[model samples]
Target chain A: MSAVWSITKKELVSYFTSPIAYIVIAIFILLSGFFFYSLVWWFNTQAMQMAQNPYYFQQININQMVFAPLFHNLSIILLLMLPVVSMRLFSEEKKMGTEELLFTSPVSVIQIILGKYLAALIVLLAMLVLSAIPTIFTFVHGNPEPVPYLLGYLGLFLLGAAFLALGIFWSALTENQIVSAVLTFGTLLLFWVLSWAAYSARGLWQDVLNYLSFFEHFDGMTKGILDTSDLVYYLSFAFFGLFLTHSVIQFRRWR
Target chain B: MIETEQLTKKYGDLVAIQNLSFRVEEGRIWGLLGPNAAGKTTTMRILTGYLPATSGRASVAGYDVFEQAEAVKQSIGYLPETVPLYPEMTVESYLGFVAEIKKVPAARKKAAVDRAVQIAGLQSVRKRLIRNISRGYKQRTGIAQALIHNPRVVILDEPTIGLDPAQIKEIRDLIKSLKGEHTVMLSTHILAEVKEVCDGVVIINEGKLMASGSLEELARSFSQNDGVYLKLDRADGEVLNLFRQLPGLKEAALDGAEIRLEWPWGQDLRTQVLKLCLDKRLEIREMRSLAMNIEELYLRIVSGGMEQ
Candidate 1:
């Protein structure tokens, strides 16, 4: 456990000391802030128009009108930004020959992988926390349901964790960070678009695609509904990606 | 402290090392001497638990390298051919991190780093970032990281590959100082380095062991006969003829003012030669045994001039 923490602390220090962490955080906050502003503006305009009619005004809630779109936009932003956060985790070690030091040390491979994975998760958490600033405005000016609002951020965190794990696996595949990032982005985009193909498919194929799509699992937590299956899906997806990373590292050692 | 038996590694059909075996006793410095692509790094990697051997066994500090890798790693320190360092970290922080992962206790981690810094002579640049330090300091930092945990065996692959002569001497001196407490196995292609620092040598070429012994032992084993040189004040054909009369003389030659004579191994003719020179009224200037240096021994072994 101390070995794992040592690796984690060193990785965290490296992440913050380099320009990659700041640049990634800056871009995520900027995009999420813009999305929040536009969504809230559109929500205000729709609320004004709906207030004249009682039936339409009943449908206007802050959770669905403003926060839901913002959460969805933040997920997209995370999908793009988290790969950059994870690209250097293993790629830089291999490129700089530091993997030799790491492997020759007494620490296990799982500890090293978990250390890097947790560092990326921490960066993802930081970005999520910073993006919550715009949501705080809704809490102060209007009464947004705190439960669903917090759940939406929970969904986003789980989604980002899954994306970061896959990114780490891709990073472990190659020494070139660019290639790792591109492969991660491409694989995540494929999983993101799986639901689009599900719409045209018939029978069990549609259900399988929907179940496999990240959008399906993340959609429920955006609202007030917290399904155990959705939580299990994200956690299992993360575990599978980490398992693949471990296999790759172990295979490389013997090869 | 370190031993390997028939350690072989094969990448598909290509052999990296085949039937390579050597032993490094505790508290002695051994040099792994070989040409480029001679499997020196591969052997060290296997011994350090960085890579697995295909069909052999290795042990470090009484732990099996493959079966008990973690235990072996805890007892060994390794520096690869490329000095692996985090360029963004200061030398002290880097050593601290190494000590942490190497499982130094929390209370002793700071003291471990301090001891390593003192031993590797890294105090001058301990606060400097690795990227900004000179190459010599960076190499020392690498050594410091390896020693931070105070492992029983230290394996350094080409530790002085790229340094100025002064820096090389400094690094060599540092390695020599590790003779009593640490069992060091350093790989180098420089023959002079082995001559200067190593107590014994393991020479490999083309992925096979050529020779392994002390410098004098290797020299004596490789040469067919023992030889001596005699410098005289006056030497002519008469002196050569006088030396040729000695029994059991394998060969004799006169060059310039010196006479070179060779006899079978284990033969001592020095007293006879001195008596002959004294009775002949010849003045002697300098006389010394002609033993092959490491350079000649390495060349002969690597070139396959002598049988393994």
Candidate 2:
């Protein structure tokens, strides 16, 4: 356990010292701010229209109108950007031959994968925390219930963790960081776009694809409705990704 | 102590190494001598538990590498050929990370890291980022990481391939200084490194064990038949005949003023030749002994194995 934590701690330090940490954090905060302001501006426009014409009042829920879109857009940004942090987890180690040091150490393969994943998760969580400042501003000025923001943050975190695990698996699959990043993006994009297939498909197939899509699972929480099934889905996705990562690591030594 | 029995590793249809067996006693510096693609690195990887053998077995300090890998890894420190290092990390932090994962007790972790830093001579640049350091310092940092936990066996693959003479000597001296406290096994194609530091050697060619033994013993074994160079002041065809006349001298070749006396490696014909020289009243300016050094032994053994 200490071995795992030690690896995690080292990885975290590695992230903090590297320029990538600052780059990713700055990009995320800037993008989240952009998404937040856009949602606020659109909501203000609708409110003005309603004020000018009483019949134009759409009876829109503020949480659903502003917080939901902001949460969803931020999740998309996190999906696209977290790969930068996660792509180097195992890929860079293999390229630089540092995997030799890692595997030859007293730590186990599972420990290394978990350590790297946890470290990426922690960094991603920090980025999320910073990105949430805009949401906090909304809670203060927009006068919406904090429940949606809190729930949406939880949803975003789980979604980020699941994506990070997937990125870790791809990183372990290849030594090229570019390849890992591209594959992670493509895979996450596929998950992001699965709703399209669900929308066009027949009943049973649509239901299955909708259930499998990450956006579907994350949607319930972002809308301020907590579901055990959604949590189970993310936990399972993360576990499956981590399990595959472990197998890649184990097979790498044999090969 | 380290031991391997009939170890084999195959990549697809290609065998990286096969039927390899060797042993190193506790607290001895052993060298793994081989040419490129001779499986030196592969064998080290296996013994260090970075890779598993396709067949056979290896044990380090009473722990089977495959069965008790964590214990073996815990006890052995391995520096791969490329010197696995994180360029973004500082030398001290890298060693500290190694110490933590290597299970150096938390109480002694600082002391252990400090000892390794001192031993590897990384004090001045301990706080500098590894990428900002010179290649020599990077190599020293690699050595420091491997030695941080004071493991019983430290395996180094080509520890001094591209260093300057001074750095090579420093690394060699550092390895030599670990004599009784650590069982060190270093791999290299440089015979001079083995001659200078290793207590014993294991020579492999094309993934197969060719020869292995104590330094002097290995040299003498492969050097069974050698040539003696003789420079005579009264040098001529007559001297060549004089050299050939000595019984047990297999053949004689003339090169400028020197008469080359070819004989079996174990045979010492100096006394017989000196007596014959006195009888003939020949003025002997220089007589080279008919014994093989490590270079000749390595060339002969490697070439001999290649031919077979």
* Model 2 agreement with the true structure over A30-104: per-residue lDDT tens digits: 988888888888988888877776666657568988889888888889888988989999998999999999989
Model 1 agreement with the true structure over A148-188: per-residue lDDT tens digits:
89999999999999998999999999999999999999999
lDDT for model 2, please.
Answer: 0.89
Expressed as tens digits, the lDDT of each residue in B178-266 for candidate 1 is 99899999999999999999999999987899999777778788668888889998777888889999888888898666789899888
After superposition, candidate 2 runs with Cα above 4 Å error: A51-60, B223-289, B306-308
Residues B7-117 of candidate 2: C-alpha lDDT, one tens digit per residue: 999999999898998899999999999889999999998999988899999999999999999999999988998888888888888888999999999999999989999
Which clashing pairs does model 2 show? B224-B265, B225-B265
Write down the lDDT of every candidate, Cα atoms only. Answer: 0.91, 0.89
Q: By DockQ thresholds, what CAPRI class is model 1?
A: high
Task: State, as a TM-score between 0 and 1, how close model 1 is to the true structure.
Answer: 0.95
> Per-prediction count of colliding residue pairs?
0, 2
